[model samples]
Target chain A: MIISEMAFFLLVTGALILTVLAPVVLIGLFIKDYFSKSIW
Target chain B: MTEFALDTQTALFIIVGFALAWIAFGVWLGRKNKSHEDFALAGRNVGYAFAAATAMATWVTSNTTLVAPQLTYQLGVWGMVGYSFAALGLLLFAPMAKRIKQILPQGYTSGDFIRLRYGRFAWAVFLVISVVYAFGWLVSLGMAGGILLEALSGLDYYIGMTIILAMCVGYTLFGGLRAVIATDFIQALIIILGVAVVAYWLIDNVGLTSIHTELSHAHPQLLDLLFPAAVMFLFNNIFFGLGEIFHSNVWWSRALSFRKNVAYKAYLTGGLLWLPIPIVTGFIALAAPQLGIFPASADMIGPAVASSVLGKTGAILVFIVVFSALASSLDSLLAASSDLVTQDIYHKLIKKNASDQQLMRFNRYCILSLGVMTWLLCLPRVATLGALLNFAGAFVASTIWPIVIGLYWRRLQGIFAGIAMAAGTIVGLVAYFWIGFYVAALVSCAVSGLICAIGVVFNKSQFSWHQLQENEQ
Candidate 1:
């Protein structure tokens, strides 16, 4: 299977952007958890 | 058997080189292992980098390569995009990293929480679903090992399977989780770097002009953002992945192996890094029309493209990446499965007073026994890899709500939790042969949630918030 340059760029760029942001999102969750007092 | 353009001997040499190098590194890591804690959870010392890499690597498997493409081909663009929702599992689990390390500060297995928080019946219910889900997962890896070997090396499936399972089980049993995690980090690196390199190479070779012309003229479905399977893929996959991680003790037990700070860092990092996998592997299949190689099967596209693009050497690299993926994933499954059996089944049932020393001794046996059972089960064709795995997704989706609610909902009674999981699995299995996964998860979670909600509203049993406490966590 082969993808077009535009398609590949779109997919790879999207994936890369998400990958870069994954850590930031997790960090945000970590901070939120630190302050929360729910039962879970 | 499929014939790649690459020479078999060269491929073998390259793969052997990588495996031998990683095995040596992993063996060396295990030499300092002294305690059961060392054996099971890497003495709670793994750093964020190691944890993050292993988690990401393990979750992205042949499925991403095999199933993702099939979805793209059938459902169009939305299929590929829908699958991306699985990353939500890792993202949701981000805060769970801290909670697990904090609440189960001394916890060893997912089963530990059940016993302490939900009592014997709840523990028993959780154990059944977990074992079934885990065993199914182990079998899929074993199946992948054999299928890849047959595809790449023309080795007989059984011979390929036995060798793969034995090697994975041997190392994990010998060095335990410590060995598994170290090897996992390196394997994760190979997968990430290899996929990145190939994705770039393929794009350069194919060129954008030719691709757009070819795909639009032939498979215009590739451009469709929302296909008919939209609702099913979008919601069910996210729910399925989340349920698997949240309910099974496998991940937390693995998490506990890392040092507290490291575990948190690793999960956060792993969650993000894991985001690229589905696109990398799945999109390769999407490129099929331009390569003049229509994918006979979604799973075969990765190997085929590697062979076609980079010739024999690239094919060999693909093999190594897949092999590394299978090994990394299988070893963890073996380690975690055996840990559950030892900690839940044996300790709970056979030996109530088993000492740490005795437990460790029994755990070694559990590792081997579980490995053997899974090896036997996975040896069969079990239909296609995609179908077999989807079958599992349906089964576990039912248990998701019960687990999530049990963890967080204070009023969820023990009876409600236990009944919910049992009834959910039973109903979900019924849905499997008849309906789509989205319908199954939705129905099952609803069934379980309703039971728990009813218990909360009308039951005379004392509802203690302590049943699912936030103590220290």
Candidate 2:
């Protein structure tokens, strides 16, 4: 039971980190694409 | 219990402000349009960044924002994980998208591929499935927009639904695919950031330990790894996702529009980025019991929990994120569905020689008409989002095997493919009525796959890939 609980928390934490990073990476790529006229 | 986090006036102000801004942005983007190809396919030169962002953002619809939590609330931990498996649809489509681009570089919609690859009979059956799924999705998003507003701010369902439909239709009509993709980029950022903020706040304040403990004591099934129903749902949800992506023009149009080399990697990256979103969104529902908030409906639990815990600020955040998610999907459906109607129905069937300028104008009209039709369906506030979307599973799943085999294998003839889709859908709908929602997609896919296999074994005709390239102007 405790193991299950711990696993849930670990998954949530990982998901949170990924969620935050998604936008940053997308925005970074957007800037690069925009400057290069690749945004079309 | 109808208390609002943000006052009605403030909510309306924000909604109106955002709607106007998006419409203006769409009009600005429309200035670059010079031909029908630019209008429908973004001139077929979309870059890696925009392509990836559009694919990810469009896939992150009201389903991910709203239905993910709803399923988690009902089916427990397995539900969230099952919902996340939808990313597999996009992930698997990476290679298929590459093939689609290579085969039909000038293709405008999935209907074009079906028509050219198969024949008129299969094309007609495919259109019915496409229309049903497209309208199912469009109406669901419209209903979700209203449901989200009313859940968070006590807004009227009619008013909210009308505003969202009009706003999306406005932008998509003016800017075409360019506006849709461009706004999708910005909307994607807002959606991810908003979800991440609310989730982090929940973790910081309530703590996952308490959430897990509360569930174990009170809602143990939610945390149960061996929960039977949830296990069944895992595979069902996966097939539904696969069917939705495999046959939908929304993804096909994006595949057709993207620059040659970008389709495969864009879909791959988009799928990876989309994988964790449902987990993040659905995790909020597990905290609802700890916060002492119970929603009238499972679908409303996401906004209800966020607003109850974080107050006015959280309500505002939920509003923006859900609204962004809804618009990203709504605009894409409008653009893609309109492309299907204009290219397949209007250009191909009605007027073969319609000029490029005329086709572009006709496409805009189709967008307006589709918006109006969706608005009417949304006004009644029919079924819950989950029920409505799962119903579409019966129709879309039948296309999976036919589309997959049709793309790679040449032995499957159009007659068998058409019958397979038609018969599979009929049996799947029967199962949906008799058995349950969870098995609809699974049954549909299985039946269709069997039929397609039979077709491959017996049919002797060889399909040339060059046929797909021949008909395009």
Candidate 3:
């Protein structure tokens, strides 16, 4: 069953976005963690 | 005409070959086991590649080979894709690894982290849930092994299971992490090559056109690369995988086995490497429709379907792959779980002054006892694979947030972390027996996330950044 080209594009785009965003989220969390350190 | 004959012989060869190599490697490393720490965590000097491969190989056990294809048989395209979500477990571990190593660089087990990160009340609750989770998982693999052997060798399930479990436990009991890692590298290599070969040959035998032709009408959903069911399961499967790796001693021990720098890259490399295995190996079951061979259980789809397509030879190849997969994982679990006993339960509590040599001796004895317990438990094969595993999934989901959030959020007070873990576990456990584990996990994750967020919001006290940097030394 051939997925509609439109659906194919959507899924591919979604997966690609996730793949890229996963690392970004990790890095972002790390940055947040770094800044939140105790002042003392 | 014997079923899985080719697979059996081919598998036997690979098993013997890998075991021999492992024996050689074990002998070289075995006597060097100077302490329980050396045996269990490799003195924390393992490199990225070894850590990554062992982690990937162990996580992708019989379930990937069995359940994933079974899912494909029914859920169609979503089955393998849903299973592929497991790779997220490895990828998600990367950041979690760095944070965990920083906070608890010398941590011995998952229990050790929970002990330091939370309170005894929470740790006790976590341990009960953990024991059940570990046994549930061990039994799932056991039941799968029993059924697989029954199918291939025509041997009774009990006999077949004993053989497989004993072989794995035997090697693992003596070798420690060094042995587990050495064998795992070989096992991982064999499994990868075997899966690729059968997949290539499968496409050749049935051809993609025929597969599409047969699958299009009977189960058109299989053809839809991203069907509705796949999307529905997408997030759940991801959480399931994440929960298992995130909270378990299995992954934590691997983290502890590596040098600090090696730990991070190992997780990253392991993540990327595992991404394609589900797609590569599990899709062969799509060819099941072409053969019209539907085993009563779907997890059996990979072995049965592959055997039919490649004939006896393919069956044997699968057996070898399964052997490698099972041994690699069982050994890792045995070694890691024994480490837990040595560190968390033994050295810490019973024998604070125990020399490293004395501790190593106790570890081997613990390995023997635990092996017997898991063996006796596996004898029954009580629950269906999916039900048993989903229940185990709930247990881990209970730990995920406390683990993930607690790692990054040091301001996380022990009380809040304790409440999050305990309350989430209570709710999840209640849901599992009353409702189902998936629902339990869903509720647990949501509730635990809220509790953890509340802890963050309140900010009673915070850990200094300098403390973490200093601890790494």
Candidate 4:
């Protein structure tokens, strides 16, 4: 029942990749909102 | 006491600098809030980005930063994964948020809906649950601020706790929900980047493979998928999260505040963005044993290990991220709880004829009182962050069935809904004391759900959706 190292690596790395993309998505949305003047 | 990572002076400097800047930002944001609606619900015109960011950032509380690591340290891999499952709370609430905005277009708090939908007895019960859970969460966040400072540097717990409480109240008192949402956007970005940097450092420098190999050799249970206690913890955590989001005014207020057609997508995006965070933050603790760093308290493992590996810079980064996480949630709770007291109790009960100016002023005073009350309670350092939060889980999980059923179903009578919440919370608390924290939410949810099912079966009247559309006095 132990987690394989490969599974462990994928979990962390995949999470890391998603975590890194969060800022990009958030900023892009902010820019869109800012241009449209709807960020309130 | 122990060898500090950043010196006390440096820690104090960081606190003062950030506190001043955030308060000034709060004042700047307060300029647009001329009406009670503006202060309390951010003009009820919030757009997608800010709504989504506030939703994500506020959910990233002391629990995510501090308790996630503690759970991972204690319950192993299942703990972090179980923690991430909390995102389901937000995801599930997405459509419900849209429904809330549609039905209660003029609603101020979750208390409003409960009162209108269920009547006085259930509203009273719901209010008690809301107050208890709000204080529980507020105290935990306050304690976490103190704990974070004390863990990183040699800062006094009392000073650290007081400063954080004061800063949140100061800003929230003036800027209201507008400031809370605006700051949340920036804090969301800061939290994400900070966590990413720390995790990346661990991977680049320490290597996850070595960390995994070490855990397998030394702490085999950490990788055990079938770990018994962790398996039990999975469902309980999910229920706890569901209860928190479904029942609390914090999420409801955001749903009320977002502009037309924004609540659903905002919450969905926020949940997806939030799903991976606990994994990133929690995995950092798996490296603790490999680094030969054991903290005095399990909750300190996140900061202790990060500081040990990345040194002073890492300590600073952890401080800011955790601090932002604390403020984002703290201010939201303060504002939301104050809204509950102002709109639900004060305006509805005490003075029905109060003007907008009076309501706004009273809301500010409520924020101040809540901050002071939380500070006094946090002075004792009653329990570890994880324990205190889970204790509230029993209280909140009791509200899950009542809230969900009330929203979509018309058959549940007020008396039965009241009985359901009261019975659920009582059983949940009994379980928390007798069995353990892990089963409290599960037991509570089950009891409440059973009662709600009976209520739905026996009740005979259909509630008009028009009842929810209460206008301002």
Candidate 5:
């Protein structure tokens, strides 16, 4: 039971991390596109 | 009425402020439009960043933010994971987007591909499916905007719905696809940051150990790895998402609008970015019971948990995130669906000789009309958002096989493609009533695939790839 609970926590935490990181990566790419004048 | 997390006045102020800002930005972006192509397809030169952002943001819809948690609350852990599988729609579409760019370089809508590839009969059938799915989604998003506001703040359903619909239509009317894509870039950022903030707060405040322990004691099925119903729903949701993206003009127009080399990678990046969102959003619902926040309706669980946990600030965040999600999808659907009407119905069928300027005017009118129609349908708030979306599964999933086969294979005939969509939809609807919503898309996709296989095996005439090109016109 404890093992299952730990797994669930790990899964949520991992997903949360990815979710937070996604915007940072996208915003960086957006800046690159903006500087290149590629964002038509 | 139920008590709200924030006061109605603050909600109204935020809603109005966002509406004005988005509309003004849209008008500013519209200044560069010179032709129909510019209006409908953003001059067909959208960059990688905007394309990927629009794709991801549009897919991170009310369904992802609201219905995902609702399903998780109901179907447990597998439900949230199943919801995330919707990213497969965008991922699989990467190859199709490339093919769309290659085959029909001048394509304007998904309807154009169907008409050219399969002919009028299949195109007509495809249009019905497309319109139904678009309106279903549009109405759901409109209603979700209202429902979100009402859940977090003491706003009336009708007022919230009207503000959202009008705001999206106003901007889409002004800037067309360019405005839609640009706003989508910002909205995408807001939605992601807001969802992440709420999830992070929930984790920090409630602690995952406590959440898991509470769920284990109270809602054990949510933690069950092999939960049967959620397992069943997993693939069905995937097929539904695939069908929605594959056949709808929303994704199709984005594919067509992007610079040639950017379509594949843009969709792939979008899918990857979108993959974890449902899990993050849905995880918040699992903490509902632990937080002692029981929403009157399951669909409100996401906002309720966020607001109840973090108080007024959380309510404001939920409001903005959901509003952005709704507007992102709404504007895209309006622009894409209107493009379908203008290109496929008005230009192709009604006035084949209509000038570019005339077509652009017609497209704007179509957007306004579509907004009105969706507003009427959303007025009553007839069904839960989840149920309304799932019901559309039967209609859209039927188109998956025909589109996939038509794109890559050469043997499938127009008549068979039409028959496959029609027959698959009928059977899928029957199964929806007879079996369950979870099986509708699965059954529809299976039936359509079977019919498409039969069409391929029995086909005699070979379809030339060049028929899909605009040169035929």
Candidate 6:
């Protein structure tokens, strides 16, 4: 029941990629909210 | 004396500088808070960006940054993956958040809903559970701050703990929920980017392939997907997380604070963003064996590894990131718990005719008092971060079924709900002491659910949903 090396690599790398995208999405939302005057 | 990653002076400088900056930011945000509603619920009109960030960041707590790595070091792959399942709590709460907004549009705390929906006995039971879990979490975060500073920079535990507690209480006193959320947005960014850099460094320098090979040869259990203890821990951790979010005012206050249409999407997005974080933090511990860096205690593994690999620069980075992580949740808890005491206990119980201005003033005092109480409790160090949290798991998990059923079902009566929580908590504590921390939440949730089912089946009266619309004095 050992996790394969490929699985381990994929888990960490996929998480990293998603982690990288978080700031982009958050800031983009902020910009959209700022323009719309909806950010309270 | 043990060698530290950063010298004491630099750590103190970073702490003082960040403390001043955040307190100033809080004061700036406080300018618009004209009423108790504005201070406690961010005017109950928070937007998607800040709402989403606060949800994500507050969830990221000492547990994710500190305990995730510690669990990974102790339980292997399952620990981190199991930790990530906590995101399910946030994800599932999205719909409930929407329901809460619709049901209790003017709700101040989770206590309001419980008291209105289930009456005094159930509300009393709920407040007890909430108080126990809140203090458990508050003390854990406080201890973690001291532990982290001590571990990374050779700072005194007492000083570090006091400074972090005072800093959070100071800002929360100034700005309330507005300060908590705004600071959380920035802290969220620092935490994400900090961990990403450290993980990337590890993968580049240590190489995952080599690290995996080392684990396979030396610590095969870490790579074992079906490791017995880890498997047992999986569901318990999920239940613990569910209970934490489901019953705590931390999430509920956020729900009430966000704009009409924002709670669901904000929580969904926050949960999605939060899902990968524990994995990134936990992966740091997997590299420890290869680096031959063992920590004095399991909880120190994350900081110890990062500081050792990246040297002085990394220590500062870890300090700032961890500080931000601790503060994000610490301030929210301070504000949320204070709101619980002020709105639920003080206004509803003692000061029924208190004005909005008076409530606002009392809430600030509550925040100050909670900080001092937490500081005094944290002075003793007590249990390891993980142990203290899991103990709270027993108490909070019992409220899970009661809260869920009370929300959607009409047949569950207040008396039965109160009994369910009380009996479930008793049984759960029995299991926690007799079995293990891994089984506490599972056993508690199960017992509570069973009682809720019986109550649902046998109870004759239907609850009117309109009762939740509690009017302010």
TM-score of each: 0.88, 0.99, 0.87, 0.99, 0.98, 0.99
- Clashes found in each candidate (C-alpha, N, C closer than 3 A): 9, 0, 6, 0, 0, 0
Residue B77, candidate 4: Cα error in Å is 0.4
- Per-residue lDDT tens digits for candidate 6, residues B220-262, read 9999999988988889999999999999999999999999999
Which residue pairs does candidate 4 place in steric collision? none
For candidate 4, write residues B287-400 as lDDT tens digits.
999888888899999999899889999999999999999999999999999999999999999999999999999999999999999999999987899999999888899899
lDDT of 5 by residue, B116-173 (tens): 8999999899999888898999999999988988888878889989989999999999
B129-196 per-residue lDDT for model 1 (tens digits): 88788887888788877776666666677877776777787778777888887777667767666766
Tens digits of per-residue lDDT for model 3 on B98-126?
Answer: 77776777677888877766657777777
What TM-score is obtained for chain B in each of the predicted models?
A: 0.91, 0.99, 0.92, 0.99, 0.99, 0.99
**Candidates sorted by DockQ, best first:** 6, 4, 2, 5, 1, 3
Task: Enumerate the candidates' DockQ scores in order.
Answer: 0.14, 0.69, 0.07, 0.93, 0.65, 0.94
Off by over 4 Å in 6: B470-473
TM-score of chain A of each: 0.75, 0.80, 0.65, 0.96, 0.83, 0.96
Regarding DockQ, does 3 or 4 come out ahead?
A: 4
What 10-residue stretch in candidate 2 chain B is worst by lDDT?
B1-10
How much lDDT does candidate 6 score? 0.93
- The 10 consecutive residues of candidate 5 chain B with the worst lDDT sum are B464-473
Using DockQ as the yardstick, the better of models 2 and 5 is 2
Which candidate wins on DockQ? 6
Report how closely model 1 matches the true complex, as a DockQ value: 0.14
Interface RMSD of each: 8.3, 1.7, 10.6, 0.6, 2.1, 0.5
Worst 10 residues of 3 chain B by lDDT: B464-473
- Per-residue lDDT for B434-462 in model 2, tens only? 98888889899999999999999998879
